[model samples]
Target: MLSWALTFLIIAIIAAVFGFGGIAGAAAGIAKIIFFIFVVLLVISLVANAVKGKAPKV
Candidate 1:
């Protein structure tokens, strides 16, 4: 999910450089949503692991 966000961010930058305002805006918006979702999921996973009182399997 994070990688997808990064991919979209790169796309946005390239699009912006090429003067594609619409595409850049859309990609950036998608990247933002994905990034936030990733962060939220990560936090939830961490809390779940802590509450379980066990180390994550490597």
Candidate 2:
């Protein structure tokens, strides 16, 4: 999921370089959404592991 966000970010950069305003904007928005979702999921995983009385794997 993090990789997906990065991919979209790269796409946005390339599109912007090529002067594709709409595509760049859309890719950036999608990347932002993916990044937030990834962060939320990561936090949930850490909390769940802590509740289980185990160290998070990393």
Candidate 3:
């Protein structure tokens, strides 16, 4: 999911460089949303692991 956000971010930068305003804006928006979702899921996973009293595997 984080990879997906990075991909979209790259796409947005490329689109913006090519003067595709609409596509750039849309891709950037999607990237932001995906990034936030990823962060939320990561926090939830960390909390769950902590509550389970298990150390995260390296």
- In model 1, pairs of residues that clash are none
TM-score of model 2 relative to the true fold?
Answer: 0.91
In model 1, state the lDDT of residue 15. 100
lDDT of 3 by residue, 1-58 (tens): 9999999999999999999999999999999999999999999999998888966699
What's the candidate order when arranged by decreasing TM-score? Answer: 1, 3, 2
lDDT, candidate 2, 1-58, per-residue tens:
9999999999999999999999999999999999999999999999998888956697
Q: Scored by Cα lDDT, where does model 2 land? A: 0.98
TM-score of each: 0.91, 0.91, 0.91
Q: Which stretches in model 3 have alpha-carbon errors above 4 Å?
A: 54-58
Clashing pairs in 2: none
Flag regions of model 1 displaced more than 4 Å: 55-58
The 0-to-1 C-alpha lDDT of every candidate, in the order given, reads 0.98, 0.98, 0.99
